[model samples]
Target: MKKLINDPKNVVNEAVAGFEVAHADIVRVSHDPVFIVRADAPLHGKVGIVSGGGSGHEPMHGGFVGFGMLDAAVPGPVFTSPTPDPILAATQAVDGGAGVLHIVKNYTGDVLNFETAADLAAADGIQVRTVIINDDVAVKDSLYTAGRRGVAGTILVEKIAGAAAERGDDLDAVTAVAEKVNSHVRTMGVALTPCVVPHAGEPSFTLADDEIEIGIGIHGEPGRERIKLEPADAIVDRLLGPILEDLPFASGDEVLLLVNGMGGTPQIELYIVFRRAAEVLQECGITVTRSLVGNYTTSLEMAGASISVLKLDDELTALWDAPVQTAALRWGR
Candidate 1:
């Protein structure tokens, strides 16, 4: 595996340090390890927003930390959950007088850890609310399992709900918007190649030259199925079919589409995916209201892409269009 880093053990802290130097105006490191809070944090009675997951999905929970997104992000080990201590610290650091909202993905460890942190914060008299994002349509939701893992769609929830909080919406209103976003979004992903975790020092899973795994999770969990490699259009059909059939987004439904790249995919390939995704949406009579493409979230050196669709209403569209300045995404001049 080829990567530019000194040691696997220090990867998270080293990356966070570099991130702080690169985005000094927007983020600051906590006294605790692997936790990054907004430089302008402690929004002083504004509902604090905290989200995190394993490392390697850069520009996610961390890159979203800024003026109108997440207020703090707790980092886990590569593709692992942040333990209870850092998560609790993140909750405490961002909690203004209003409350703190934890945006947790639906992974088992992540869900359990964030849930524990929320409980601990409540014990400290900090109002803590959480919106668990399980937007991945790939996983079968059942009584036994943890449901679908939260994927790229969580970014949309964070953006829209953080906008609500930035406008001085109450904690309940912020949490409500987050829940609303969670309801509107669904995602499915596919992988062309496996990614090598730094510590693992090898690919998490293997894919042959002419094979692709459909319905992949970001962390290299087993996908729904593996199929022979096909052209971009055919690949998109496979990706979008379940999303459309299950969600049944009908004609004239306006939507937001995010074509996200796993770390190793190129922009050219992403655009190829986007081109077909747009065509498929148009053919289905769905209106593509807004679109974002590129590596908003990534697994470490993984060659894959996930398509996330959020059916949008006026409120969601307005919140999505609001100004956002962060290291990974910036808009609204």
Candidate 2:
């Protein structure tokens, strides 16, 4: 309930306004039907990439709008999917004649809305493709999704796919690269505390002081189980076990390991988790070639973290190393 805002109903609008002003150099915002696009959009001949979901996960679809990432991002209300109108607007705004790709997380509302927008864009003569990200190894189905709920691994899809598009890959090629990333990546999260939506004025879920939820979804959905608080290494093992087993990532496999904060977890704690995760991977003979540890995708101000492992090949490794300039993630630029 304690948040800095003028009104609960206006949280998204106001936040979007602030974000526009703060990151103006890299992005431009459209108000009528809210959407964020790279400052220099419609990169003719390069495939346009767009992804979106609820607004709470900052620096996600929106912060990722820039060169070598997303061309456009449509954000809905907190933990809510955006309507078709804004999605279509974003699609049109980024279409540069080559095509547009929709990188949607596997949420029911997001999937349907993006599908509708894609059909509408197609009718307008814009070639459109869609890739559903289902990288969560936590659950096969959640209240918000029919299949495995997409989690932190979504950023991997957007980044890798955007790199392919930036390199002038065609629509099909970009979509293929996106699908490949989704398939190779696996993620699992643990929540120590729940987040409160601005409008709701109450935490989405409850957790005892010494309790934790393992395999949690980004939107505060029920996870695999709730258990007493354990050491950071033990929790990391629980999460990474399912991920490594699900992908069957074996010895000699190279990976890009991401230790992502849910929202409120500190950077120091994240590195603590990463240390143990790295040690475990080394023990298994898996090579941690690339690593990312931070709050890239979040759920408002929840105190938690998720671990993502992306099995990498030579092509994926190169694409991941490509230059990217975005509000949240900027390197090799």
Best-fitting candidate, scored by TM-score: 2
lDDT by residue (1-333, candidate 2, tens digit) is 788889899999998999999999999999989999999998888899999999999878798999999999999999999999999999999999999999999999999999999999999999999999999999887889898998899999999999999999999999999999999999999999999999899998899999999999999999999999999999999999999999799999999999999999999999999999999999999999999999899999999999999999999999999999999888998
Q: Listing every candidate in turn, what is its Cα RMSD in Å to the true structure after a full C-alpha superposition?
A: 1.6, 0.7
| Residues 1-333, model 1: lDDT tens digits | 788989999899888889989889889987455689989889897999999989999878899998888999998999889998899998888988999999998878888999898899999999988898988888775222377788899999999998999989999999999999998898999999999888889897899999999988888888789999989889889889888877778999999999999988999999999999999999999999899999988988889999999999999999999998888888883
* Model 1 misplacement above 4 A: 141-145
TM-score of 2: 0.99
TM per candidate: 0.97, 0.99
